[model samples]
Target: WDFLESPGTDEVLYGGAKYGGKSWFLCVWSYLRACAFAKKHKIPKSSHPLKVGFLGRKVAKMFRETTLDTWFKTIPADGYVAKGNPTEIIIDDRVKILTGGFDNRELVNKFNSAEFAFFAVDQAEELTRDEMALLRLATFGRLVVNEKAIPGKGLLTANPRHCWLKDEFILNPIKQRKFVSALPTDNPYCTQKYIDNLIDSLKHRPKLLAAYRYGNWDVLEDAEQVIMDSWLESALNRHGEYWPFVKEYIAIDCARFGDDETVILLMNNTDIKEKIVMPYCRTTEISGRAAALSHQNNDCELVVESIGSDLGAGVVDELTELGHSVLVYTPQGKSSEPDKYYNCRAEAWSKTAKVLCSGVIDEDSNCFVALTKRGEGDNYGLDDTMRGQLCTPHYKWVRGKIVIEPKEDIKDKLGRSPDHADAYVIAVWAWPFISMPNKSGSVRHRKRQKSPMSM
Candidate 1:
């Protein structure tokens, strides 16, 4: 009711978990508003109909089956009539209410050229940021009723999901926009039996239950996350423990886009000794190569570079010419264990999880450790950012093989590339561990294996 009463607000989002009156509210509110606008400005007898409002969903078929049904159930029968090619509701003889699908380019193009007094979308989380922008563009300076102008308005309804809607409506909304949180319990008509059924169905899936039943926007996805928050928290400040070391590895993840940062890490055995990030600029490639060279030690066994840009390849070529061995780590390339993993990136991240939790390094019983700064203010450095990034990339099984989420989707959720986590995983996967000398000054060489099924 507050949303309908407030004329100053240009856009509003009514979102939450399932069984919320989102669909009912959007359909009924838009219908009533269209009718009210028509009643205020009665047109001439022979005049053409005016497009008063629009309603949409992700797909046309789904819109017809879901939101269209809700609109039909809640509207009056006498004055309004459904007509047109794709079916629009005509109210009070001359006002038209249109419907379109966000995924249908043809319908979207047609609506893009038309104007409306208001527009509403149900299940709006399925639409991309670009599609939403285009929907908003259609209403600019185009709202008119009987040749008189009025303020254009928009309303969106969605269930909890990790998308731009969460960022725009929940995290950092603009002044012109208002957010109204809705839950199943918010609707007095919602039945207790439906709530119990939802709880029973999602009990095994904790993340989904939190998102669908509780409207937790922070729960990223339903798939298994690669790194848990508890694992990262447990491994903090573990570099002080004593561990034997004979091999050194360096990993570099180059900046692929304008806003991305180039990340470099130096690891001695299972201990992460150093990490640094520099913003991308004209001298980033040159500075990155120099940074990689500066971290090299006499005991450095191998250097791995994950390249997604020409700048990254340039660093590899320059290092190869300087008598240093460098391996190109392709994220989409075939994994060494093809039967188990979908790609090298997935394999690397899975191994890193084992190292973080409890994986034996050489004869030592220590796991991977990272050093922390002693002071107070922002002492976590790239480690803190890496922890947040690490917790986002989820994995799922496809045809009996594990496949990690795509890099673009992770970037969408994080608002930046997971460069620091990428570098750390590369160091863990490509590290060449050599056994330390025994008590009798005898060296024993063995292939590194945590287990047959482990890293």
Candidate 2:
């Protein structure tokens, strides 16, 4: 209340653990306040109804399934007109409850044009920052009551999520924002059985258990998420198939040393008409030189190949002797972009992060809508093991620069080496240079045209 009632417009984030009745609070509080504004203003039924906008399908469901029962069973119906048309209610002709969602443009447009005494945002963390901004704009100058102005207020409820909510409210507390981390323990109505069910269902997903069950807002996915789980899930669920093409390179992380299996990721990046496609991935104990020979025998492009540094240097030298081009991944080698990273490995991870975070490709169509030409989206073969590996590494901040978790540390957490992940990250690093006309580094000193995968 202090934050909302203070002297300026504000948003209050009621966030943290799951099943804390946070959404319930946002709904009732906004409605009750709207009622107060209407009654105080002596507003007539024909006058512009005082309203409080509710955002998200979940909130609408809550109001319909549970909240409606509370209002009718507890509060007298004579006090207000309660009608359910996909969930809208009125109390004493004073307050109008408006609900909408990202999928409903009509609801969004209504909010855009109308004024509200306040707004209620449910599962706000699921909304992008831009969507929330639009809601705030809708509240502008609409908070007048009783011939006086009150600051436009927004109450947002959310489960634990690593999104703008975490950044604005907790990581870097924005001015005038009241961010609360509410736990199940803090709510008397939140039952132990409910909490126990969540714990049981999420026992295998540690990240979720930390956020939803424990409400550890300061932790969870914030941990070194080198590559966030969201990105991996999105990528895995986004695309299904790809066709092999020219402008290909094979990157292999050799398992010559131990229990690790060597991984070969065959990628296609030949045309600017399409984002890169990684269609073929293989795991084997085959020697590096033997793998090269196999591609050679098949009359494959076999243009560029890279080997992990952990494996013996023999295969790289042998491939060179056989007149095949092979690049060796050097973790401490100079970075392509030194400003953000210390070395090639770190830069590769940075590149992977960039592609994942930026919505360069359409989710359903798997098309590269970000490009002016509008081509197919970059794709990777779906392998659950590879997906798990892709999300395994945690990032570290070294001298203010980002770097991947050390092999030792990653192995400790994963109980196995991230060979497939290294193979993929190194493959991304190899794309710009590997496809360079036969002479890989001859044009290195000269500026080259951007790879289709970039930007």
Candidate 3:
């Protein structure tokens, strides 16, 4: 609390175990700022209004329900009255707090020009680096009243996740700041019994317990990789044969020689659903794996082959003989123009990761299930495949939209060759066919629209 009130600190990161008073602290800070602005600005006590923005990713509604609702209850009934959307709050006409989701780009831009005495971001880990950078720049310049001082600072409360913020903001040399670690025990209002009960409930759920109870970023139990659990869950929920209704289906094939598993990932462009119908561990011959692919939805046309060596080429030939369209891609020579190695493979992996993180891909289905079941521990062929597909090089956008440049080094350096990695490349290659048109009517339309499968 003291550090928050202190001046000169431009950025603050409050991360720790969940059930802590982090959310409450943000509420208090915002309320105090609103009250201060009301008193100092000399606008009528009734008419003085301060605008504050709260941002989140998926649980926008949940955030409002928990934090914003709790905040209102904490304030005396006579001091403030609830108004506007439940996601937003109008406190005694002195403060207008707006809640927004990160997925809605237009809504996020609303804060770009508006000045507020305070700004808060809940679940800061969910925000993209681009979004954070935009908010930072927007909050620059003079305040609404004080033409000299910056309008207001921003507060970020989140459970630590594997993200750039861990490196850029928290560890950045320029931002001389301190991080406050809060635990469930820190909340004076909550009882020990209550905290214990909550912890006990999450004991069986390693990921949740690690994130919410223990505040450990390294603990990702269910997912073999670091992809968000929500993304994985959503994918699983949307899986079915109806997935073929999408425009394109691309399969990425990563072959395994010895203890490794040969994985095949089937992806459709429409809803971004992926199915790992074939993930065979300790497989040598490609013929058995080829038999598995034969069982997948046959309507999808295109297979992207991640060319590795002579053995990989043989597998591709076997797949081709099965009457499937295939595109063979090999790594560009180290001296090839920009970078050596397969640029397409690298781009495909990067694109796949972006889609997963953006919550665009659905993982719940035969594909994910097969991959997880086959790839376990030190023999994480499928696991490495997924990570390679999801971890792409992203550019930092200080202002406006940022374009991501592909990285060859990242593709080459990632450990192990994954059959699922091949599937990721295939999925990305087929992405354009699946993407839905923007509401704004920005692009040309493709004539063929595939039918969706039953969920």
| TM-scores of the models, in the order given | 0.50, 0.47, 0.47
Give the runs in model 2 whose Cα sits over 4 Å from its true position: 52-78, 84-86, 143-148, 220-455
Using lDDT as the yardstick, the better of models 1 and 3 is 1
Which is the better candidate, 2 or 3, if ranked by lDDT?
A: 2
lDDT (CA) per prediction: 0.68, 0.57, 0.51
Number of the top lDDT candidate:
1
Cα lDDT of model 1 by residue, 112-148, tens digit: 6878778899989878999888878777567666467
- Clashing pairs for model 2 are none
The TM-score leader among the candidates is 1
